[model samples]
Target chain A: MSIGKVGARKLMASFAIFLIATGFGMARYEIKDTPPNLSRFESTIASGGKTELSGIVVDEPDEREKNTRLIVETDNVKILVYAQHYPEFEYGDELSVSGKLKKPENFSGDFDWAGYLAKDDIYYEMLYPKINLVARGKGSWVKRQMFALKAKYLSALSKVIPEPYAAFMGGLTVGAKRAIGKNLLEDFRKTGIIHIVVLSGYNISLVADTVMRAVSFLPTVFATSLGVLGIILFAVMTGASATVVRASLMSLLVVLARTTGRVYEITWALFLTGFFMVLHNPKILRFDAGFQLSFLATFAIIFLAPRIEEKLHFIPKKFQFREIFSATLATQIFVLPLLLYKMGMFSVVSVPVNLLVLIFVPATMLFGFITGAVGMFSALLSVPLGWISFAFLRYELGVVETFAKLPFASFNVSNFPLWLTLAVYILYGFLIYKLNRRNTRKNQVA
Target chain B: MSQKRMAILLAGFIGGVLLRSFLNLGWAFAGFFVFYLSFR
Candidate 1:
């Protein structure tokens, strides 16, 4: 599709996402009824101490206001079992608890499971055991193994890099923690390079292509299948967080479209991904800021990047790196308003910071992966591997540190209304579309 | 460039600037607007 069309679509889709998200937020504010569902359950010796109940887990640790609670159904469900255990249970786990539910007490923070579960109009009841039983699904075993393997590789790769540089390398490779260190991240934030740190379509696709290339000896169909499986495994390993999942899905879709010799529609593909993810967990629409930001930023790239590229086509391809840089800058332009609307802070240095960091990011990731795999086979080689990896990361850190030190690297804007953010995006879309049209006609006349 | 394409381009430029102006992105939009018009 033409760049202008993509830009227009991006403008519309983001607007839609914003509206739906607002609707969910509004629902949370107004819906108030029923006392907290406090299920208390105890089993007779005949039934055994095990109890099973169904519940929804809204597992957002940060947004305590949106804590998860289960509505379980049971015939003799009046019993409330005090689930005396850590509240860090994964979201969406169904349980058959053989425990007792207790009355409401002076508990601080959000609703106690006993009370909250009861209020959900759930059919089952349980005040779970303090020494409780938790079983992650056997169905999730394959995904779990993939995540373990991916994380293992990431951690191993970090060992090869120097103290602080290892963290940044890990972030680039496997979307590992904020290990790139706070100060470096601050630099990236300032230069608008934070997207490089965040798992994005470029990172995922590069890795996917690398894996596919290695398996090229296999039949085309077989190799494609393996690549898709690898992508899925990588997504699972990355915690299948909304952003990671979305990027992985897009990468996989792009590959699938290309392999089948068909034109791909990135916007529709992205829209479908968002729709499916939200359908699976409607609460994510309200509760997950990462989910919103990931989709928005990516949508901007797919829609706006091309239009910007075409408008500036006067630049020679030999200097084509400028196109990549401009595309990055343009996406960030649309992304910043939404970022500021949600994050309350925008990094002024992020654009330059990202440009510098991205130049090294792909190379560093490749080296990190090779060293990680090598270490798995031979610890003896780890030192050299570690040395090489560290060298790449060291330079990366130096650049980040320098940019972060610049004045006005970060600033905050509070209470920017959603309407204003949306309007900015719409205008950006119109501008890109206009530029592309002009450029296309100029080329035609030439 | 055809007049139609240039018109679209100018429309986008003007619309973007007006919106940015309306929303108060500060002086950055002025330089951008001038640059865009000069290109046309």
Candidate 2:
């Protein structure tokens, strides 16, 4: 399974070619020119410090947060709408916000409307008047069916499980975090266990493994297919986001590689995943910071986490404390760079804070799932589950509050230059190469 | 390295850089670096 230098060289070339072709193809698409009487989406207008945009219902402003801008789309063109008196706008609602069209600052890029759709991957939708409420817009029926089935299954599971445990577990297992309170979310963030809240590949695998174990009595093919189908259903139920899709594809590729007894390269899997995503929507490559962050973080975890974990393996295997500490350190080392780049903060106490928070995350999520499931079945279950959910919520809140209140919990890294960050990344890469090579040699002899 | 794999990697790296430069998408360079380290 080791990739020698020769193999690496060949692979690198192929990847480069692929990237060039794709990049050229992406750049070839002509972006629509702005019309003379352009309007922006209402939400965009609300973000900016302006008023009188159509469909804007002004809300009370917080004095603390500043420099927020909004753009509103109306009448075939996008316009910059100020955030002075913005209204509450639900996602997917179409509004014809009329305003004076102006080119906004700080959004210069190949991707049209990159500034407006940084959080939302709706760059492509700018060409059209209405934003699709769902991803792909083709899987709505299947998604609905899966959702209904999930509700049914959760309702049934609630009969046997405790209250909030079910609710938390639902979130952990299925990626539905609606029931998770804001306080719990804050704790998970501080602890770096927020990935657990998001239904990543890890969660998908956990659910799939459980299903496969339950069906082990069946033949291997049937069991494997059942597990796959179950996961696909779960993915749909969780909205089948780009990250989830990438994870599912990677997991599926891994399984297929195993079944075929051929060692598939993970790097290829990553490239192919990105290639497919970009092929589906070229605009995704341009806009969508969440898509960018999700993939980048996963890349860091895959490529960098192992190098870190190997360095800390001197501690005895059976020593539970060492294992937890090493695991936390490894993941944090990789996550920190990307985290800072995205969030502009370097959490000084994130390591220890995450260690403490990790202890409760699994349990909290389990209880949450249980409670959420129970609530689906009856008021009988909801009553008890509500109390448990509340308890976990309270504990989670306390943890976040305490950690956040710490003297040096985190500090801003916004002032850091991009070159410095890239230099750090290069150094990190060299370190991993040296460390991994040494470990590989040791492993070969052992 | 096999010719095929080498070709793929080189193409991805060079092409990514050129595309990023041409399209004015500076982030493509970062993506190329990711490809280099990851696929390299």
Q: Ten residues in a row with the worst lDDT in model 1 chain A?
A: A56-65
RMSD of 2: 8.6
Please provide, for model 1 over A271-363, each residue's C-alpha lDDT reduced to its tens digit, 9 standing for 90 to 100.
Answer: 767665654443344345566677766776776677666667665665346666766776678678878876668887777777766767778
On a 0 to 100 scale, what is the lDDT of residue A205 in model 2? 52
Model 2 misplaced regions, further than 4 Å: A1-113, A116-139, A147-194, A198-201, A258-268, A282-287, A311-324, A381-397, B1-7, B10-40
* lDDT, residue A419, candidate 1: 84
Each model's TM-score for chain A is 0.68, 0.64
i-RMS for every candidate (Å) is 14.7, 6.2
Per-residue lDDT of model 2, residues A1-446, tens digit only = 56698788755656666766645543532231112432344455457533333322111111112322333333434333344323433222344543333334445332335443432322212111221221211224565466665666556545545544454455566665345555555555654556666665555555555555676678778866776776677667776767777777776666667557889888678777776765555445545444555666566656666665566767555535455566567666765665675556677776776566555655565565566566666757566665665566556556656887776666667745646666877787788778778888989999
Alpha carbon RMSD to native, model 1: 12.3
DockQ of each: 0.02, 0.19
TM-scores of all predicted structures? 0.64, 0.64
